[model samples]
Target: MKHQPHDAPPGDPDSALAGEAEGYLLARAHHDQARREAEDLCARMPWLTAAQAEDVARHYTRKRIDLTRQMLLSTVERASQLRQEYETRYAALRRDLLKLHAAGVCAALICLGGAGALASLLSR
Candidate 1:
């Protein structure tokens, strides 16, 4: 794959995908660098053939894949932690709201009783 960095400037119509485009360019550069190194190694060592160079590239690719997988797993773990914290805060707010509602109901009932008592005294 061929990719070049900074093809689209910031604020360009395609800038929204700049991060992904940059990643692709970086990955391509890394692969090309590795391939060149592998070729040089094969050239320096007469016994090592093209097949050995291919194997070296394959090994590096596998290492990169493993590292990406680890990063993704850690991200998932972080997301789970955030979700738990949000749930705890939501539950606390719900409890506080319920307490406030109960207090309001009690206050209304006390006022109604006081009004009824005042009316009876006035009638007598």
Candidate 2:
């Protein structure tokens, strides 16, 4: 019932790996482009001190890092939620299976006792 992310295909391992590789390439390209743009900014703005240009570049890098951090936190939260849901389902299934096993044992014992009584009556 869980939906696959836009990057990955569902149900096929090879396609999923390919999708992950594609996503990595795309992210790498984006980072490269951002770095190039930052360098160009520093090159074009000669009036700004070198330190100030570096600061500008750092600002962009920090923003990107912060965005990645937020995404990671969201993914962790989703994982925790899924873990809780699975635990709850497992507990319910275990309880039901236990009840079913007990019922079966009880039925077998009753049948055995009835057979024993019938055999005794036939012998008498």
Best by TM-score: 2
In order, candidate lDDTs are 0.74, 0.81
Model 1 Cα shift for residue 35 (angstroms):
12
CA RMSD of all predictions: 8.3, 7.3
Single out the weakest 10-residue window by summed lDDT for candidate 2: 1-10
Model 2 ranges with Cα > 4 A deviation:
1-52
Q: Report the lDDT tens digits of candidate 1 across residue range 13-83.
A: 45656666787787687667766765665567777567886786577666665676688679878988998
lDDT winner among the candidates? 2
TM agreement with the true structure for every prediction: 0.57, 0.58
Global fold similarity of model 1 (TM-score): 0.57
Clashing pairs in 1: none
Query: How many angstroms is residue 59 displaced in model 2 relative to the true structure, after the best TM-score fit?
Result: 1.5
lDDT of 1: 0.74
lDDT of 2 by residue, 34-97 (tens): 7777778778888879899999877876677568768977998999899999999999999999
The local distance difference test score of model 2 is 0.81
